[model samples]
Target: MNLRKVGSKTNVLMMLFCILFLTSACGSTVSNNATAETAVATSSSEEKTETVKKTEPVKVVWWHSMSGGLGEAVDKLVADFNSSQENVQVEAVFQGTYDESLNKLKAAMDSDSSPALMQVYEIGSRFMIDTDAVTPVQTFIDQEKYDISSLEANILGYYTFDNQLYSMPFNTSNPILYYNKDAFKAAGLDPENPPKTYEELAVAAKALTSEGQTGASFAIYGWFIEQLLANQGVEFINNGNGRTTPATSSLLNSEASVATLTWWKQMLDDKSMMNLGRKTDDTKKAFAAGQIAMTLDSTASLRGIVSSADGKFEVGTGFLPKPEGSSDGGVVVGGASLWIMNNKSQEEQQGAWEFIKFLAEPATQAYWHVNTGYFPITQKAYDEQIVKDNLTAYPQFQTAIDQLHQTKLNLATQGAVMGVFPEARQLTETAIEEVLNDSKSPQEALDDAAKAISSKIEEYNLTVK
Candidate 1:
């Protein structure tokens, strides 16, 4: 068998074993054997003089939504932490996908069985803040007096709510363009040169797409809108603050936003861009299968694409293109962050904080990025000589960092804080489908979306306030 095929099969088997272990262990109950201990103690006092260790370990429960190799990487982190720490024990549970994890977390909150920490996505970040379900991570760090200057400002903005930090930004990711060099060459385009402007990309896409290939696609529809709006200097909501202000309302129907939507609609109309359906999982799989030549997805998708292609594809990564005659704009960060859940004992809270800090350590951050393709959230992590040396070998890893050079803290691009963002995203995606199918013009579709989403947002905001 091919070496890469063997590696793929091995990865699958390892994942299967891990799932089996977790499923069996979660259902099993182990009782303390006081009777057996009593029998053992019945021996001679001299023989029993060997001193037994008798302290219960402090347990910290962490609920997260990482799967496949990323999940394995997290498990490794937990094992390393457990092996090194004598007083605290950490249990990292795979709580399904992002939406599933969020629902499970809310259910846990209601049942008084919530984990000490839970992974939360950007779309739901605001809801997490509104409910007061999460304890502020910055407060914890300040109380413990941990050094945080090394954490980058750009990353801090993503989780900041009302000027106060509420969550530790873990697994942070941003959008980047990934293309296949072989496809570019076949299309008679420069393999090393990617589109710098959206118009240029559209032209290149027309040439690049064929019967079995697509020019470009995106993993997250909301992320694409986020970037497009930023590129066009448009805001999705109105508030000086990011993701924390309940007074903010939707801006999906703005002129710039309408233009962005129009561009996507035109692409679909021309058949130069393919909508391989939504969902990051399906899109990434299609790209790895060589069915698509270019895709814009989370930087974290790098690890999965690399693994799936098994080095068979020549991947070329670049910063997202700016629209013609417009300033290049920022892209909102797309990954989940670790949030501290409420109602835990002080000791457990502190222990959970320690784990969060452990994740922030420069060395640990480097390990995670190298293993999972997530961008480093702290300058200290990337500044490490070791991390820098590793990047020299994998230059594409820096595409996101380069993209950040153009980023600014614009409220529209920083992120939105509406209570029903997930639902809004679904609504926006529906509009995208209508545009792709030519059911309506982009403006018409988005206008309908804006009204629908605004109603829901208002309903949610009212309850939260």
Candidate 2:
């Protein structure tokens, strides 16, 4: 307290010391605060940069088996998707035929190097779904906010497993009979009238064939065999699920199956039809060359026939004839659907989903159907003005559209579900080859095939369990 009474100089010196002390303390506090704030700003900036980097475009690899120009079309689809999307780039990789694609997919899955999406055959759907490696597309669409109501019923139901859609139906086709119009007329049959029942077809097939032209060559594959048996109301197995369910007995050895085989055998024996062995392309060539008057093959064959015909022959199309007095059962869908792989990142899954939605769009479906002769998978596409406008321009395609209208909801016909269906098909084809070559009677051939199929079913069932 006595320090206040000090001399003026002394007082000035004391004041200076106090001022310096206070100034130093305040400057130190301010310096510390400045450093803390600068650090916070730097940390926040880094976080924002990291967030942007993580949110950027994701790559989705798609493996497929579509070949030739169809393969090019798939690549174009991916390119277009990449161009349109900023957050996703789809890579479309060709994996070969259906069997090859499945093998590659299996290998990829086992190695955990699976693609984001893969094209899989219909017969393989049950096997793939059962493995739990695929996320159902319906679930993906729902989780990812896609509109599934726009999808066509026939297609939507094809990929549905236990009420969940496992795959997106793509490149769909059905079996149809294609005949040469000129050949029909030359045989003294009405070119406009195609056989509407199997009985009529058998008679017409006989009349259509001559020494120069053969009638009704169908592929020896199970697709046609399955269709024929389904048309006759025969169940290939005890359960409606073809190769998927574990049924011990081969019900395909039933009377209807025997009848169908015998009919084919009769045609072969009578020389009314040509059994060109197990090759589909061979039959296609014979029909295209006008050497065969009629052929049953995929509806997709329309484009090839139209283009390759080169104005040489008139091509006529019609629905597959049912057994007489039998309701027209649904023809099993042929072609592949898209499966989402489990190895993709969350961001990539979103992108994969986006591309799938793009492919499922009604306009996209219409374009695909028109260009490739595959049926449009949505009612919206079929009802669109564009489809209506082109109806006159493409009359042959209308036959397939009409055929869909005749489809019944029989599970036997909706399709066969089995684990080893591809193998079963090959076995059936072998039997057909034997029957055609006189190695065995039709009954003996089918019975032998049934035994082989029965053994496969037992094996597949064990795996399913």
Clashing pairs in 2: 243-418, 243-419, 244-417, 244-418
What is the C-alpha lDDT profile of model 2 across 272-291, one tens digit per residue? 88888678899888888888
* Clash tally, candidates in order: 0, 4
Give per-residue CA lDDT, model 1, range 1-465, as digits (tens).
Answer: 122322577775754565467565532321123344455566655364544334667899999999988899999999988898777899999989999999987777866678988888877888888878778988887786888888877778878776778898998888888888888899999989988777888888888889888777765376688666765556776554234346445678888877777777677668877787778888888888888887888788775666676667788888777778875457777788988877888788888888888888888898888888887777888877778876786677777788765687667556766668888888888887788777878789889988988788778877876
Q: Residue 259, candidate 1: how far off, in angstroms?
A: 1.0
Off by over 4 Å in 1: 1-53, 241-244, 307-313, 383-386
Q: What are the TM-scores, per candidate, against the unseen true structure?
A: 0.83, 0.85
Worst 10 residues of 2 by lDDT: 240-249
Each model's lDDT: 0.77, 0.78
